[model samples]
Target: MNNHSRRRFLSDVGKGMLVAGIGSNLAMELGISNALANDDANALTFGSLEPLVDLMQQIPVEKLQPALVHEIQRGTELKTLVAAGALANARHFAGHDYVGFHTMMALMPAWRIAEELPQTEQPLPVLKVLYRNTARIQEAGGDERLHTAEPAKLADTRRGGERLLKDMYKGDMQSAERTFAALSQGERSNAYNDLQHLVQDAPDVHRVTLAWRAWDTLQLLGYEHAHTLLRQSVRYCVEREQERLKKDRPEPALRKLTPRLLDDYKLLSKKTGLRKTDDAWVEQLAQTFFAATREQAAEAAAEALAEGFAPEDIGEAMSLAANLLILHDPGRPEKWASPEKPKDSVHGASVGVHASDSANSWRNIARVTNQRNLVCSLLVGAWHTAGQTGYITDSPFAFDVDVITSKKLDADALLAELNTAVQAKNQSKAMAVVKSWEIAGNPAKPIFDCLRRYAVSEDGALHAEKYFRTVTEEFTTTRPEFRWRHLIGLARVSASEYGWPAPGRDQARDLLET
Candidate 1:
């Protein structure tokens, strides 16, 4: 544990990252693969080794409560406006929807990463090389080739892949149903095992748990929307799994390295009573997603562990999360909102509650603004408390950085167009402007203008306020997609500022009528 060894360890990491640098044109592989941590005696661990666990990894591990608290205070706005309110209302604004949950879902994890490493040796240089390298491959269209790749990275055989999404999006319901039905439970189970292993072993569990804890924090504060939370929170897991799969490792190697137990499952079980449990964690997670009393969600998670739900249960949960991810890839966050076409519905039904089946079919009602990012602070907190961060996050490049180097967006003009769309109650149009915004390079000023003008909740307002003004201004060469997503939500909230609801069943169908 001397400086000499630490220096060597970091140097080795740098070498691997350099090999995987942006110039290599290979999709980046995340995790501490082939790193010296395996050899090092003093490997750094995240969360706590004992009872006073970071739990949500929010305050203790991530020191994220301030950020969450800050976001809640700054972003909230009333229908009619007067800047943000004087004081914050965490409970009032927490469950504003998936957008807020998603914002934190992404934000908290990044913060946790920053918190994990030693502040003295800023690791951005190392992470930059790896992220840039991986992004190069993705940008070059290599990562998506698993279906056609030489090794065929991971198998999607019976479960399904993006093809199912295309079918659904293209209104091929018959084909979609056949594909969904064709998924033999056996194949699904197998795939789940692989995915579960991925979840238990993936390096990004730190980030995923960070996001999960963020969900619980939101729910505990009062933001709960069950189906929406489950649907979206799963995306974080998908994000991690995708990042892992992009490395194009073979199945056998993955299985070999993948931990059979995330840790001493028995020890974890005894500590938190979460051993050999069932879908209790699912329900525990649901209480928060559904926005139950903090007490209810806490009790549920505790009870699940008391019943013996261990990481295997988490593996099953990851399987479901992976399926949801395939159903909706994390890479294409933009697709979350395609113009809702009535014919897209199979039987004029919506997959979730309160969704209008006026068109009479199973439809993809998911939108970026779905606002169900179930921070899972409680659920994740339980796991984080029971076990370690379950991640060897000693590397600098924990995630792909979307460096902010693009053309500038005209804050005033974009706002004008965005305002017009919102005032017009044109959901599609407003969405278009948000997505189509050539919002790049020094766009923070304009981004903030939108935040102040139309922030959906205090959380969104706060996050946007600080990020645009501070993070973008301070950091360089990072993925601005998170910002883009945030801005998109701001636009949606702005558009809905005057009570313009997301066009309901019959109303949405009427779009074709016009």
Candidate 2:
């Protein structure tokens, strides 16, 4: 074994091993590529390619043909080619291009495509190719056309479904349901399941998606299914978020709940519950929520109300909802009514027009009147409780009455007195006097005379007339036993004094006869 011979032998062995290794590596690489090609070929088509092609063929050539031409002119990159392949498979076959030709070749059965490839190296270039081809096809109005359910449209739908699923997983069911509804059933199912996994791991997300799905399903299915779904979702949310729910515990739970507070909570619960039951419940709940929480529920309820919910129902729902909300945190301060006006304005005792000299009582009456203005309905209810509309009637001013009187005075004397008051422009005094006389239960002659004589001068006369008309109508309709002899008498005098024609005097005559 000479040195030269040993070196040559070593070199030869190294060369042979290197060559063998290279051959093995190439074989493995080729084998892997073939397997990948095979897998790619078998990848899901969702549906037949011909249908997509047919649909694409139907798309206006002007709209889709141009894009295909542009892509062909541009030639295909891998992304563009993949896009083209997808387009071709989806039946968007416009015409041949180097990229599409290569893509089809790569996807050919003899190519032995793979099931999946690393995303970074995946043939997204095919997408660009497809885009260009589709563009040309769309522009030229070639064989390939766009349709409502084109591959591109379906791809977009799929993308939207993915986004919706993500949102649902994050506990945005409303959005998810919306996205789901826009998708085909297969896409919807995929999104729904994705959301389910998210819900299981992240309960908040689950709760939200469940509620949204339930609500959406209800729209599709009906009440029973929807309610069941809602209940299930709510239960899941409530249970899963039990720790969060604990935040609602009142600091001092032992305090006796005020009737008002209890009422508020009851109202809130009722409103929220009603929303789950009635289609229009959302509107009412929103109103109640807003009323209770100073418009917190406004956004939620706005859509429902805009769709046309009844105002009264909304009001009641808001009241109920507010009550429920208050129960969860009863430490809220009470809202007080505004302060009352000074008593002198109301009792008229300061004007010396009334016989009642009870100063403190008059002041109280004024205070009550001021309160009445602030809360008319509440005050009215309270008055009704007191079993007397006459509480207002018996007063020297007769809060409800609007007239003037003067006993032992002729019509001329009454007119003169009224005229003097009018001339002096003592409108307040005139009204006060009129109201006093009416309160005193005087006959209509003096009251009507005073009004007619001075009405031209006194601004209060307008208010007086309205009151007179209201009272006259009420008395005429309600008190059948009391023939409106006073009204008739006053009408006759009014005609005489005002110098109006008596063409309708027959009506007055009939009233008198009655």
Candidate 3:
């Protein structure tokens, strides 16, 4: 094809088509170009990821949905498509771009969502995120860049983790990457465990969730790619450390505090306890964390673990402390009502959401990590929750169930009221309805069923899907009496962001429907 002919072909294809949503060579292999009756094209492909990753990166933003939908129809596995997206993201953005990483956070949740949907519609969530993924790749000009760091030798096997943390904290990217690469070759779980130090370095939602999500994604992508997946967290930590140093911010106190807490509590030497505590103990621990200073919170958590309280029980208390932030949040109504505020500003990405996600991550991390990391994670979760003290109002976000005329409303009626409150963006009413349902001895299933509808449909500023999944997983892991609280938090947040659809949600849906 001549230059003029190619130009004429692009113009004839319509300006709205934007970039191609498949690699040029793969397009040829799939006979996709022949389908379009075009014969000539040029593009780059990375043999490491081959056709799928290249195809994902080449996808035009406007056509990602239709393109993915086509691939699904042609017998492509959804997991393969998602793996490609993850590889494409890690390769291009290397865990640096805001949009790139947020999309990365959503990948596993989107895959989970796809599993529950009917076959034809299963790809919706996957396509929605891929659209965002490819759009950012398009904006950045493309995914020609590759992760170029070569693996290095660890000087001392016993102290590699220590050296890695020190290098990361000092903003030494080259040293950290090399150290992480060396560690990545040793043992998959051990490699993942070492990085938990950085995940718990501070309470940033993106940092914690990305680390957890990347680990979660490994289950799908397989542990063989663990190094590539886990490297994102290392890079993220080094980048943040660099920024903090450049801005002259104080070193995060947790850097020093976490290690001290582990030693003072003798936590590193103790085995994680398996004894579950009673409801009163859980409540008391939660209150202690709620009112304690950051140091006090860490101490209380250390003491609990030292005293043989189950890490899950200790985590339950931290989870309650997080729910308290949402239940007691005092932001003015206009803050949520503003068109200018990001949809997730108050509810989706609020301090409460961050706390919940962070606590959830730390809790799960404790389950899989080594004893030292388990100890560090519990302490970090408590400290993170208590750090948000300024956001806790004098009272709980008002959800007086006493206002209801009758406590005897059946499940359907209660759910109706809950949906009404959510649609109206009435946070207080939503909480009241959920509490009423809980008080009525109703099964929690009906309520989760109600929230699942909104979770799948709303854009939630990229948070709804993940937070809902977080709450659902935590519910099963939490004690019976306290489990209802997670539901109430979800209800309030779902209600708060009820009407704000994701920016391009309609277009993605329309593409799928047609």
Candidate 4:
């Protein structure tokens, strides 16, 4: 073989290789087109996809494409094409002359083919393709791009409307409110109309979004607007699933709606026409509301009590009732008084009498000792309620005679001793003393009298005043009382150089004046 013959053979081989490559490329292109065509032929089409196009137009440029992608992936196959076609229209209508409409148009058919194929056989390998792209579009602020109108015209008002709805769904209440406010009346109406359409088509989704919007609107627009939104939401829930109006729906929206509905009923009950003479209806509403949500009903009941009863009386009654309940319970803080010491029994006899006929001359003194201790206990217990500073035992005389005489102690010392005895669980002594004190007479009388004496005395007077003042301050801040002693103390201190004698004297005075 010569050089010319070898060259000719190599050239022939090169041509063969080029022809094979061209053939392969042509086949691949044709296959892609065929697959797209087949998918388009089988794909569902819903009217010019104009509505979706219109919606996409409202989204911002950066968000527009990604959101379209998201809707396409998540929506029905037909819906996806509509979304894609709409996106293409949005791009073209925005007038970027460099990119052919066909290039924008091509994605619909490709997505359609992807939709038609089994999900496992779909190209681009992962679900992230849809999700990642959608998120990117959102992050890029694609929703804002939708606000642009055509070259000469403002964008479709509905575009802004949908954005508002989306903002509401996102819990961006401030933006939603601002957008709604910025819209002209006509635009606002159109937005709501669009919302109505969306909601009518997908009631479940609408319910969730509407409930959220209602709550946000309530925060932004005050109770009136919030109430209106709440009513609409309640109606929607009731219309969609009447069972929701019943007690069983655990959907937070539905649950929340029930309370709102009850509130509406209560409001209605205040009307002159229906509620003025209709006791049964009012009762029924009250019962239903209470049965539905006891906590709300209780709050309402409390408000009613405030309106119907004197505030002071109602408050005192509630406190007293609650305290009584606790007092009755053995485990409560105020249960038993301190115990007494054990003592021998005592027989009836004069103190100076001799033991003449001796069987056993002396008898146990338990009864007498217990009686005396009981008086002391009662005095101490009652002392707790004296003029916001001292105890007020059930009986003043019993404390003076049984507790004071037997123990040879003053009121303040008795109070300290009582506290110690109670803390030590000396219940028998505590109860005995308490009983004896109650039998003595107004038990708190002594405590107040003792406070008065201390307040006036020179020696230990300042110490007494400080103690009383501290105790009174604590009481005023916590369990304040308005008794004659407190009033008297106030009067006495009013003219003195020293400021109010008690710790919270100013507060106590204010309370008394009120």
Clashes of each: 51, 67, 2, 51
Candidate 2 lowest-lDDT run of ten: 347-356
- Which tens-of-lDDT digit does each residue in 354-419 have in candidate 2? 101111111122222222111211111111112112222222221112434435454455456555
Candidate 2 has what TM-score?
Answer: 0.17
lDDT (CA) for every model shown? 0.29, 0.29, 0.77, 0.29
Alpha-carbon TM-score of each model against the true structure? 0.23, 0.17, 0.87, 0.19
- Measured on C-alpha atoms, candidate 2 has an lDDT of 0.29
- Name the runs in model 2 displaced over 4 angstroms: 1-408, 425-442, 452-514
Candidate 3 global lDDT = 0.77
Highest lDDT: give the candidate number. 3
Model 4 TM-score, 2 decimals: 0.19
Q: In model 3, which regions exceed 4 Å deviation?
A: 1-49, 140-146, 332-345, 403-408, 507-514
Tens digits of per-residue lDDT, candidate 3, 1-514, equal 3443442344334212322544565444433332222333322223334455655665456655666666676677888888879888887787888888888888888888778777767777777777778888888774344365667776665666677779987899988888888888888898888888778886577788888888988877888788877888888888999999999998888978988888887887868888889999999999888878988999999999889989888999998888778778764355454563443335666777778887888887877888877788889889988866776677777778987536667778888999999998888889889888888888998898788777767767668778887888878888888889999999988887778776557776775683
RMSD of each: 25.3, 34.0, 5.8, 33.9
- What local lDDT does model 3 show for residue 212? 87
